[model samples]
Structures are given as structure tokens and as C-alpha cells.
Target: MAPATQPLLRAALLLLLLLLATSHQATGAVVATELRCQCLKTVSRIDFQDIQSLKVTPPGPHCTKTEVIATLKNGQEVCLDPEAPLVRRIIQKILNNAKSS
Candidate 1:
């Protein structure tokens, strides 16, 4: 290969590699967004008092968020963040009731 041609080829290869990396990242973001959308379809607006069971799920490999799964009498489960103040209060209330019972 000619000396000047080699530099141009190297630059083109680097640009292609960078574009591939960026497209892969964008694809991952789209997948994540789609997953979240699918999960949301199972969730509805739930009142705190209607929660039949509030279970805490610790963060795992796939799900990094510590979630509180609230099951209602209608068999719908809504995911909430454990760190949220209102969720914490509801969890505490449930635990206290359990203890008294």
C-alpha cells in the first residue's frame, strides 16, 4: 500500500469502528425503553390503601433498582421505588399492622 493511502485507510477504519460503537449503544437504549414500555402496560394507577401485599425485591443483576412490588386485590402488581418517602411510609404501615396482628 502507498504510504499516503495507508493513513487514509486507517482513519476510515477508525471512523467506522466509532460509528458501530455508537449505533450499538443507541440500540441498547431503544431496547431498554421498549422493555420499560411493556412493563408499564401491566401497571395501573393504584392507591396506597388498595395495596394488598407490598413486597420488597432487592436489586439483582438485570434490575439494578430496589423495587417494592405492590399487589392489589384485583391482582394487579405495581412497581414502586423503595426509596420513595410515600412508599416507605406505606411499607412501614403494613409492617406495623402485621406485627400487631
Candidate 2:
């Protein structure tokens, strides 16, 4: 490639990346609070011990049972049971929260 062409190529790549990011930012539809989910149910069934490893991502490690569990305003205990789908849902919740903020 010629020397002049190199800068043009770099500039084009950067512009493409910027456009892709802008498009993505515009694509997520705003969802109502009622339509959003906060609790996830267990699928495979897990005991108390498995709850310890739940922390895996940033802002710190995964949430322990004590940390993740919250008492709702209505006095209901919201907790995660480590079954099959439960782990996936918990991870997704964390990721979703990260994206929204």
C-alpha cells in the first residue's frame, strides 16, 4: 500500500468502528420497570454451598448468598438458588445491570 493510502485506510477503519458503536447505542429499546425482571428461579437445584462461587465479574467478585439476597419492600426474601438456569439468569442480570448503567 502507498504511504498516503495507509492513513486513509486507518481513518476509514476508525470511522467504521465509531458508526457501529453509535448504531448499537441506538438499538436497545427502553423497557418499563414492570417489564424488567429482578428475580430468577433455579432450574437444576442447588444447595447453600454452591452460592459462594456466584461472584465472577467486576465491581468485585460474584455475589455470595448473603450479599445477593435482598428483602423486598414487601418483606419477601429474594435469593438465588444454584440450579441449571438460575446461574445463567443471575449472570445475565448482572450483565444487564452493567449495560443499563
- Give lDDT per model, in order: 0.56, 0.41
Clash tally for model 2: 4
- Highest lDDT among the candidates is held by which one? 1
How well does model 1 score by local distance difference test?
Answer: 0.56
- Tens digit per residue, CA lDDT, model 1, 2-77: 8989989999999897555433121122111222221222222346767778767565764665656676666655
The lowest-lDDT stretch of 10 consecutive residues in candidate 1 is 24-33
Best by TM-score: 1
Model 1: residues with Cα > 4 Å off, grouped in runs: 1-46
Q: What TM-score fits each model?
A: 0.49, 0.25
Q: Count clashing residue pairs per candidate.
A: 0, 4
RMSD of 1: 11.1
